[model samples]
Target chain A: MTAPNGMRTMLGRVRGLGSAKSGFAHWWAQRMTALALVPLVLWFVISIISLVGADHAAVSAWAGQPVCGALLIALVIAVFHHAQLGLSVVIEDYVHEEAPKIVALVLVRGLAGLLGLIGVVSVLKLMVGS
Target chain B: MDARKRPLSPHLQIYRWQITNSLSILHRMTGVALSVGTLLLLYWLAAAATGPAAFATAQAVIGSWIGRLLLFGWSIALFYHLCNGLRHLAWDAGYGFSLPSVTKSGMAVLGATAVLTLAAWIAGLVI
Candidate 1:
């Protein structure tokens, strides 16, 4: 069978010698997350700055607001996701050893996921009170 | 795969330093630093969620001289990464590929980072 336009040849696809076929997805996701983070991070920095020197009660009250909690959660997810994607590239570029590279990738992904979860939970707790 | 001596591509040691190269490397460096800095953010959030005591502990750590210094560094890194990241995005979008344009954009990124970091710190301290 003939390969379709812009498609890999059947034999080439089967061999899989060159492309992973998923690099674009990773690249696109990184860019999308970066775009989302521009505003989210700006908002977070400004919010924290405004809350500088504020008491615990005030900070809690501010975080507890629905809008604030939602945005904070969004920020956390975007930050961790973007960070994971970025770090993965760095590891792949620097770590040439096959086994260690896999281990590092797994560790980075795990840490990113765990930290993102903790951030979400924290925001939720603050929203719920105490 | 057999372990064999092979001619590898030229790398950093061979190239002369330039703004483009410097900014590109700095971008990665800041990215790594920001990755580590996420821990501080996580700590603050967890502490805030825990209780007044925990939050106070976090505040004390973050308010200390060392903590402030780290924060200052992270802020600079963050702004630098953010601005250069936008420059990268512009390049990805097929803009600013010419040599002069690239250099100009690199300079602009540095300027933007400085202004943003300064503005953020000022706002943080003043407001």
Candidate 2:
């Protein structure tokens, strides 16, 4: 139904603020990423700190394990994804040149994806002994 | 390009530096640093996955003077971002809106970041 002289809905009152406009989707995404970071970051920092004195072989071996490898890959992805999202907002808000903003966005997406994929593949090879 | 009207000539150059302003600017600064740090993390992951030889190269870089410097900066960035992010989280929850609290938290976060960075470095050295 619709809200009108002859209809049976209240679209008139809701016209400005209802489904006509976007919801807090950006805010939600930010919060979701932030929440994911909470635990992932804690684990990552611990891992990094714990591995500080480790040698090349030890690090390789540790990261070679399936569980550790998978977690590192997850860390890489989450990091890049979060970074991309954060940079996009900054560029969108502050970059005065549209061309530069678009360039930055594309670069961030491509570079982050490439780096994250490389990290994941590296982990897989290490774990699988490839 | 679209042109917009401006009100006056007053700008950031005209203002005196203050704590709140510094925090605001440093928040963005740390965000950018963290973005770069993300690439380094990705590099570490990729190197780890490649194998012993590749991992060795990555290790050498990470152990190099330049790499150590970058890593040190990245560590500072990590801590700064974490502390500042916590402040943001608090604000999101409708807390710390008062000027005094904001400045206080800003200083606290800065201090926390410094302490954490130093602690991490000391731990790294011990390792």
Each prediction's TM-score against the native?
A: 0.90, 0.84
lDDT of 2: 0.78
Quality class of the docking in candidate 1, CAPRI style: high
CAPRI docking class of candidate 2: medium
**Candidate 2: residue B28 lDDT (0-100):** 82
Highest-DockQ candidate: 1
Could you give me the TM-score of model 2 versus the true structure?
0.84
Chain B TM-score, model 2, reads: 0.89
Instruction: Please provide, for model 2 over B14-126, each residue's C-alpha lDDT reduced to its tens digit, 9 standing for 90 to 100.
Output: 87889988887887888889888766667766766565577678878888999999998988888888888878888999999999999899899989999989888887687
Clashing pairs in 1: none
Give the per-residue lDDT digits (tens) of candidate 2, residues A1-130: 5435655356766665756254366666666677777777877787888987576678778887778777777777777777777877788789889899899889978987887677777777777773
Backbone collisions counted per model: 0, 4
